[model samples]
Target: MTATNLLPRNRRPADGPSPGSARTKRRRRPGLMLTLGLTGLGLLVVLAVVAPWIWGDRAEELGPSVHLGSSGEHWLGTDALGRDIFARTMVATRLTLELSALATLIASTVGITLGTLIWVSGPRIRAVGLRVIDVMISYPAVILALAIAAILDPGPKACVIAIGAAGSPSFARLTANLAASVAGRDFVGSARLLGVGPLRLMRRHILPNIAEPLLVLLSVSYAHTLMALSGLSFLGLGVQLPDYDWGQLLAGGLQSLYTNPVEAVGPAVAIVLAGLSASFVGDGLAAAANRSRRADAPAKATKPAEANAAAAVGTAPAVPDDAVLVVDDLRVLRKDGTALVDGVSFHIGAAEIVGVVGESGSGKSLTAMAAARLLPGGLHATARTAELRHPDSAALDLVAPGAENAETRRRLAVEIGIVYQDPSASFNPALKLGGQLTETLRVHLKASRREAREQAIEQLDFVRLTDPASRLRQYPHELSGGMRQRAMIAAALLTRPRLIIADEPTTALDVTVQAEVLRLLRAANERDGTAMLFISHDIAVVGDLCDRVLVMYAGRLVEELTAEDVREGRARHPYTQALLAATPRLDTAAAAPAESAGGPEASAGEPASAEPVRTLAAIPGRPPQPDERPPGCAFAPRCPQVLAACHDTPPPVHSPAPGLSVLCHLEQAGARTGETGTDKPLEAAR
Candidate 1:
């Protein structure tokens, strides 16, 4: 059930596909239904356009014999007026098609506007709009059409108006739901963080993503409107004298069904065929769109920078003294006052890579997001100081209410860049790589298209992506995971911001790709002097890439130490020690000494008393949820060296050495008593 058990099972992969199994996923051609649907609609449109011209005169001609049965000259019999039923049916196509098309257009326009209104409105307005739509939808489409038609004169115009109005509610409801779903995606959130205005965001991101579904809905609405219009005409409220549709022909034929059934049968066949054409098109388009989206998505299913100068403890500095971002006492809380990130603060100096290492739900990502003012709705952040300091200008207060004006946000857009974990999800699927890459440049930097494109290519090349020009033309799904991440990095560095908040940017990558990403991040920092807040649960990665490492536990900073200190086993907090032990190393088995009569003997070339090989250790118990955290120390229940006081009282910050701070009761006492905390391991101290 665990990964270990599953790993060995997949050791020897299948040499090839089993007899019936496919080796490669076959790309399906357009569905037969889609082809048939398009073909049927094409034939219908041709009939609508040319049938009236070819059969108009003959259809209105009075035959010598009325209600005649099928014959060589007059097929499917004649109507009471002695007109050819087949000719009449063919001629009715023009009127029926035009009315349906016009009505569908009207429904789509009104529905889309109302849907957008509901989507972007405040809660009260949205609620009211939805209620009205629900009430309108409660009545059957035909019933609504009848009521509207009765209010107006009985004619084609009234029928069109009635059907279109009746169908708007369904379209509106579909559009609103689709828009809401698309708006919740991460790409939309990323665009918002980049300071894209609401209208632009909706147009460029939201509407485009929902466009295909709306198109499918358009076809369906056409079909529904066509049926409703036909019903109205059958009831004598549509296509009055001198104009005839399939419904009018059906109405007249029904009165003489017993005399000559062909009159009723012919018109009924035409109506069914026309309705089927629209329904088939809608269903086929929907299927094609779904397949295309599936193909565009992966084959497999699956922030602002804040600067705070003050460290976790007074004696130890989490960031360099010359900090670019200084956030003090940052707290991100839910609407109900639950603290997700409580009193957590850190800073990043220019060109420094400060890594935040912690287990999931430790508020690592939340802290970075809060500082950038990118927290999700219903969660607000407050900080005593979230100041972005530049050498040339006064510090900008990022946390102050009403301070984030258009100018401030525009400045932040240029000053802070965020690299998200899943690059594919962060990039807009509906847009080409080049457009998304150049958007920030055009919007925030006021660069022309040519200039933005030039800069985008340069940045893409800087991130070591090959064929940068060609990649620009491709969509996000067209690139490999590593390539997409590189493109994301390029986008982040395109504006050459002062700070980059990489929230586990390399978490989803393979080891080799992860190394490449880390290298690129380091190179960017060294070359551009762009500070970064790198967040990851991988301690080894943090040690490899960061100048300083911050260990967060639960929702607070449990320890702050230099990457060197962490590498040298000088971490004072028990959580940090456990994290270090959990990191898998190739040398773990090699360093393990052999068992002997006396005890475990040191391996050859090792000291007489070799240290025990540390097997990977999982920290027992999951991190507490925000509301479930203990009143005292959040990690007290899980800490190995927990003292009695740790259950009732919070641990005090301890400065064991310069540039090293931890929150632990033992360390605090040791610091106060002038004890050298690093002389013994955490277990020995306990």
Candidate 2:
């Protein structure tokens, strides 16, 4: 079956971040130094911006002659022209800093925009743009600045343009490379499928994730711009005379270096300090932001609350009742023309959750993504035939043999929404949550501006985010991990989609949050009758969430049964049986004493007590690789139940009942014998 058809339709509200957490962790090394540096920089900036008013005519006044040494009248003595070095230094520092800041801003804005455009544009456009940027970078920046300065009037504007142009190529390349890499992430694909258009996607999703690197580049480039401006001013090709620029001061001081080296050293020190401060602040912020992100990472493994909630959600729905999604003969082919998913088929009913469980590399997630028409890059479904069934209409073939068209895909997107594993990576960090949420509503629902905004806020509320309206104004980073995932769900629900594909949605979250999210999803499904195709590596989670389960092995469906059937020890396929045995059971005898133990005895029991450990029987070997399939059965090599005929011929799919199916030679043989399939022993199959 097609992967897109694997997911069911149901979506819960978006979750927000943890409350009362510090905005970010404190910076570690150089914290005090960084603070001082920033403070000094801020003071310098203030002096520069207000230098005209503060220094005024006094800046141009020639102080007492014989300006060497710190006299009471002239601090740090005076320059060759007898201008007060203290005043000139302050004014010069201001002008030079201004020039650098403007140049840096211009360079960053132009470069990042161009880079992102190239990254997202068609391949031919990106190729051409990259080549142009490469050619620009080939020229020495200083030489280019010199030529440009000579062509234009040498002043602040000229310096700004020169430095900005010189820096553009580097920033462009950096931004483009970063954007391209982020675009390839699964979250980007999720955003696109969420109805985020290219422009909004770049602004909202692409920009935020790339901001930290861009900020670092901005700081480093600011230092470069300052130096470049100084070079041009020293050469008399930047900041005109009487402007009191540091570069000009330095050039003036050069003539009298022997008489007063302090003149040169004074302005030189200011320049160095400015650059150092910028670098320090950038480093500090970057480190702090990174630490904050790491600390905020959701906990792994299921939490007690989440497990309890899953258990409280009740039983899985019976199958063949109201199939929400259906797949037939779905196949994914490699570039070498080999099939990965080979003729897989399955079905999920309304308000029903279907679990696709498999060992690593078993094409589980691949099958689920295909159901959403979201296969990995360059991997196409060669022969897909799938459908999504709704209460009001006939089943829609998502991948009809010859009917893979844009309209069909759009229809599927409007009806089916997918939530991926990584929530942080999924959102556009640059954009506020409100904008991202509104975009989804506008696109699929054609919601008006006011209506979209209102709906966006409402959707946030649906996800249980407190103060949803205010949260909308905040950016993705402002929210916690769980909150981001919740926002993703809110965006998905804006479409009122009938089917939701949750591909390991809770994998990245802490157990507590994962439980909340699972409860929310179950509520959405049961209350709204939206079907869901829930995919996960954790069989235990599947057993808790899904009503029916489809076990996949090496790209093919190995078994299909109700969750109850699997729990009650009715799994027919050997792979399915192994998966059931592998689930961790908390209620087992091993868990009872551990729960009751206390103090020193409990600690001692943890080390030596076997207590009938509820051990999972792990499958012995790695699952079969796509390129290396066994003849009769994919599991034969790993199967403890292997027989001679299993290696030579493929097993027939056996359906003991209307809704259950298994592919095993043993089951077929047992049926062939006069024995009932129920009497077949697990060891005999192994």
Note the Cα lDDT for every prediction shown: 0.78, 0.72
lDDT of prediction 1: 0.78
RMSD of each: 6.4, 9.9
Candidate 1 structure quality by residue, lDDT tens digits, 1-686? 11111121112243555655553322133366667667887898999899979999999999788988888988888988799989999999889989999999988988888888887786678879988999998999888888899999999999999888988998888777777667756678768766777677778898888888888888878878877888889999999878899899999889888887878888898877777877777787776774223211211111111211122222224555578999877877765666667777677888888999999989899999887777765568888778888888888887777675777877687888888898667788889988888987888789999999999989999999999999999999888888899988888898889999999998787666777788788889988999999999888778777899989977788888898876666677877877776676654465544534234333455576665555466667777766666656777777666777777666777766776678788765543222212223334333
Worst 10 residues of 1 by lDDT: 1-10
Question: Distance from true position, residue 125, model 2, in Å?
Answer: 3.9
Give the TM-scores of the predictions, in the order they appear. Answer: 0.85, 0.73
| lDDT digits (tens) for residues 443-557 of candidate 2 | 6566798999888787778888779889989978888788888887877777777888888888898666777777777877876678888888776677677898888888778
- Candidate 1 accuracy as TM-score: 0.85
